[model samples]
Target chain A: MATADSTSPCTEYIHIAYPVSPIDRVTWVDLPDALWHEILRFSAVQDLVRMERVCKKFNIQLDRKDRSHGAQEQGREREREREREQEQLSSIHDLWKTHCQHRWNDKPRYKLTDEREDWLRRHYDEHFATVDYGDTAGGATGRATGRATGSRTESSHVMMGNAAPFPVANTASSSPSTTSTPSLSKFSWKKTYFWMEQELARTTLTYDELESLDWYFNFTPLAGGRGKDTLLRCIFRHGLLSIGGAGFPSLPYRMLFLHPGDNPDIFSEQQVNATDQHSDTDTTTDATTDTETHDNPIFHGGIDTSQARRHNQEQAVLIADFPLHYVSRLHDSGEWLMTNAHVTFVSTDEAGALTYKDRNFQ
Target chain B: MADEGNGIIRLRSSDGKVFELTESAAEISELLKDSPREEDDEVTEIDIVRVASPCLEKVVEFMKHYDEEKMKEIPTPLGGSTFNEVMDQPWYQDFVSDEKMNRDMLFNMLSAANFLGIKPLLDLTCLKVTFQITGKNAEEIRELLRLPELTPEEEAKAREEHSWIFEEA
Candidate 1:
């Protein structure tokens, strides 16, 4: 890609020997170091690391180290110059901070006691432990069986593993710098950012696949024992679901009310309408409703004669009772992705029936 | 020279090629806008000794057609696989993707843009460069940038130190 043939029109300009510099032909490398820095600032962390390995110039440029052996007479001046260079290199903290802010904007903020510690790297290390929860020994087998059978049991195992207290000692063992000072200069935020991207990529399931599964079952038992609010908060805190804000449709409430034997399809449709009524009602009463719904054995019981009758009736109401606007709004939003779906509920009339506006749809 | 009545600004390139642009267009470049003009003279002329003619002409073309609102903001850590994917506007993509805009020309345009203090042009050019480097491996990057090969010892050291980065995902 770099070699330009003589026949190319670009060669016409290169061949012209400007009197100012005879031996040196202007090339990309000849651009000012500052301009190179500006261009490199646009590169992703992975690209930056790869670019650093391109050549010594890039290596030295990125490292910002002066390796020239100056005369002994200028020793003091060179020492001061090196100190300035060190200061400039350390200022890369601002760049990493920008990167962290952009990538994890929704993440909660924590106070740093030591200003010099590499926050981006440290965060990556900490978050890596939390996200890497289920994939240790039987994770592959669990995911495979879950995919084949859509088994709630397999998925619950993964969720149970997620609910286990984060191994604090694991953080120390995973990050070598925990014992060291973690000096900003030697630590590469670019590498940490690259690893973080890879981790996110690994954890992300295709929206369709996640939606098809009994996702509610993943947290149903936990939600029952821990209470819905704490479970919901834990899901957000653990970064298990990538969706942002409280506007994540009604998946949490749906999960809270659902049980092992309940037909998810029926509840999903019922909850879609229930979500409308739930949003309009006082949100403070949700905790009370949550307990009431869980206590009702009708939800936990397997499909029986009465349950089938109720399902048919609810299904009929869902099909016939949905307003024209609600149907249109549902069409506007693409498929409902259980993992990353964000829907804005808007009350359309004085009757307080709810419809959602999906930002992704627009 | 800029024709005062016609609102034309004249920019002389290093190779003695002169390009004329409207005052509004020329104002995109902070260097030309801030350049001192002889008050007694009827025309305004700026000398860009660092920028060659070809690069200057492209720079003039960019400034002439530049639109702040129309230009889509290129996201950082560019998520797109292709330049066209990253920038939806065909005009900006076509301008940079021109066959004549070789590696040398591209870098020269970047230099000219930086030298003339045209921030938008600079950013566009830099984004294009970033797109070129994205998703390429170390060896591919070295070849793309025409960088010299490191010694075996140095290569081994680099591999050892950053072994995790070198591993394929």
Candidate 2:
């Protein structure tokens, strides 16, 4: 065997060829569009689906296509989303229809104070003459502005109360003359708040509203007052209506305190925790009550009421005994001034001393 | 009114290109016979305005050869006799793939094959079209096709409008 690189004669000449293959180079465009479309129809469904999404040309062919299998969960999710949207739309419609239905009845009505009486009459009296066909005849003296006129079909009795500065619902004005415009449109918050305070003070006892208070609200009937449950009722807070009614006014339903802005929790957890410390009943001052219990016949027999109380007093001493020893040991070690000792840092001095400082309770 | 001979059709291209062929040759095109047509003295119209004069001459060349090959390639059990024979040859393939025959000649050949209902010629020419067009970028294609440039304002607006396309790219 001779190698081309080693022998000059063997490497003298060489021949190479690069033949072309025409049949090997073909693509979708090789076929007529109609035949290509038929081939597309016959393709394994996966390639057909991917091709349809790949370009606008394939998209055109996919216009009338239908799929027999797709993600079933995705279909269900879409249907559920559609249903949720429909429900929200219906709820909004119902809320709006409720407002519309109550148009004339319980319509947001207003009345005027002495300062405002003139302007309301001037703007509204002439147009409202035709509104209440009966006002012309019944001589009711007050006309409602946005309040209910004829809405009476629904089940709930829409009291038609004014949204703010609740008014006297009197409707009687037969005159056609225009009243002069008044100066002030806005009412003073102080005036309204004072008027509310005055109205609430008139109530001697408030108990019925207390019935509405949830457990979180401090509710107690005003002591030593007599009347209908509604009349003799006062809560220690206002704005109770928010639990089930109108806007939240800071003062609760009917608050009673020795002073204004006083804690509604006057007898609540704050008082209980503060006074509970004095309730140990095991203090040395009550030691005789504990010692005398053992000599009493009822304390041993557990039959007499006084003896039962004596026994309880002794039991309190027994329970409080252990926690106090640590207090006593701590005191002996360094004068136990702290019964509720909170230990922060434990350090001993070089002078052979154990130092305990009262930790200001955080 | 119904008197007729063995089926055959006469095709006339837009450039006064006349082709006479049997019914089967014309019928290979699904559209040729299915038309609810009323026969008239006038020759039928087939649009071939794009078939440039020189390429149309090549198109006629390819169709003449393709029809002859197709006749020999197909078989039928006619009159209780069957004949199956195939000639091993490179003449047909070489005629189609000759690089000296320009792209226009190939395009015209493909169009004429569709019109005259010749299948193999259509396949060969269409494949050449695909090879020429595929894998070309927009700029390269625009240059090859001699399209004009986008205005400066249009370029800016298109950048904004198709920003997402660039984002994916």
Candidate 3:
């Protein structure tokens, strides 16, 4: 009935019987590396990051596993991704083709200025051999570029009129080399453009390129351009050219200048959101024209003479609409803006009142 | 291979304590299964010198339930619980948490199971230890295992890297 603390004899017996703490007698550091790896294999992937922090040894083991996985599996993932991107591009190209045919049936050709001519000559001439091949042997240039060199290609289209009113089928396929490299390489033009603008102190862009650049200047309707659909302009903005073309230099300068980089929503939901946003903004501006929104009405309603005039007006409004909002924002800023597209951040006020969507939009 | 002629096998532990088990029981360990027989009449003595006497005894005791035919049928711990609920089974709870068997002895049992190539026992021991450490905070685990304290920077980095997991907690 006596407690050890109260009795001297009992306290002495307890002290002699238990010489050390139970935990002190047990060492767990002796567990082998194989056991650790087995445990890791069974652990959830989400737990790997935590397991890595256990010790330097664990960190090494986890990182080694990751590196081994990243090698072959990542390559397979990229292959699948490339195939998916190609499919998306082909579908978009179909949409683009349909849009172009309907909009530009009676479109006027782009008028070339001396400055614009020099600009276009420098960039496009080397790839298509536009000046030399269009004039001399179109089939020779087509064969050299691995195109259908028989008779009709981008060069042949150029040869037909030097300034074709509409972008032909071959122009879309042959202008941008799709099988060359991946999407990352297409943006190398930005690096090159910076060097030219900063070092050379001037731009010698062709008239077509200048016209492409102007496509970013005002808010233009996506489906309408005055007597011209600006197919070239649309291609660059939506990454139509960069979709399949890896190292293709056909990336227009306007795309580089105006791209809203890395909005995770951009390709899927944001694309829908952007189109919806465009329509919503347009509906507010032109309330009466909302019912006549379908620019390609020929594909819908039977041809009407009054509808023809409305279509032309819509094209002018479309071209005028595209660049105005973006240009005005830049103009209001009254200074040059440099964007990397990668390093984007959202900062909230101290009160934390804004939702994620609001802060993202801001 | 014939259970009728099979007799007791002698297992010599690291501390020289020998335990006798049926040849069928000894067959559970791959090490003893392939052990060369001196004679049909003589007892096959497998010197499992890597295992301590107490741990080897526990491993031998587990080998009784460890059916080699049903080796692949070790019950995987059911999910949703923090620790593998299989550790809570009556036999496992009593054996693994024995008064004399501290953390070191549990690990020794794990090492012995691994050495003997008795997979189910090895998994059982490993899962037992895994459960002990599973839900405990890093500091508690480090203290329990007598691990050296992490530097502030390492601790900070670990927290940052697994912040999602930490935030859930």
Q: On residues A65-150, what C-alpha lDDT tens digit does candidate 3 reach at each position?
A: 33444445567776575454444334333332233232222222212334322333333323322233122222222223344422
Q: Which number leads on lDDT?
A: 1
True contacts kept of 2: 0.00
What would the per-residue lDDT of candidate 2 be over residues A1-362, giving only the tens digit for each residue? 11111122223222112121222222333434454342232222222222322322332212211221243445777556545434433432333222222221221122224422332334332222222222211111111122222222111111112111122222223222434432232211212222322221121112322222121111112221122221211222234322212342433332222222233322322222223344443332332133343333222222221211111111110111111101111211211111111111111212213333222111
| Position A157, candidate 2: lDDT | 17
DockQ of every candidate structure: 0.25, 0.01, 0.06
Write down the TM-score of model 2's second chain.
Answer: 0.48
lDDT of each: 0.46, 0.30, 0.39
Model 3 lDDT on a 0 to 1 scale: 0.39
Alpha-carbon TM-score of each model against the true structure: 0.52, 0.24, 0.38
- Poorly placed runs, candidate 1 (over 4 Å): A1-25, A61-97, A109-188, A191-362, B1-6, B40-42, B67-70, B77-79, B164-169
Error of 2 at A48 (Å): 16
Q: Is 2 or 3 the stronger prediction by TM-score? A: 3
Flag the better candidate by lDDT, 1 or 3: 1
lDDT of 3 at A21: 16
lDDT of 2 by residue, B103-148 (tens): 4455446555564455655555544443343334334434433334
For model 3, the stretches where C-alpha displacement exceeds 4 angstroms are A1-26, A44-48, A61-362, B1-5, B67-84, B87-89, B97-101, B151-169
> Best by TM-score, which number?
1
Ranking by lDDT: 1, 3, 2
- The Cα error of candidate 1 at residue A108, in Å, is 3.7
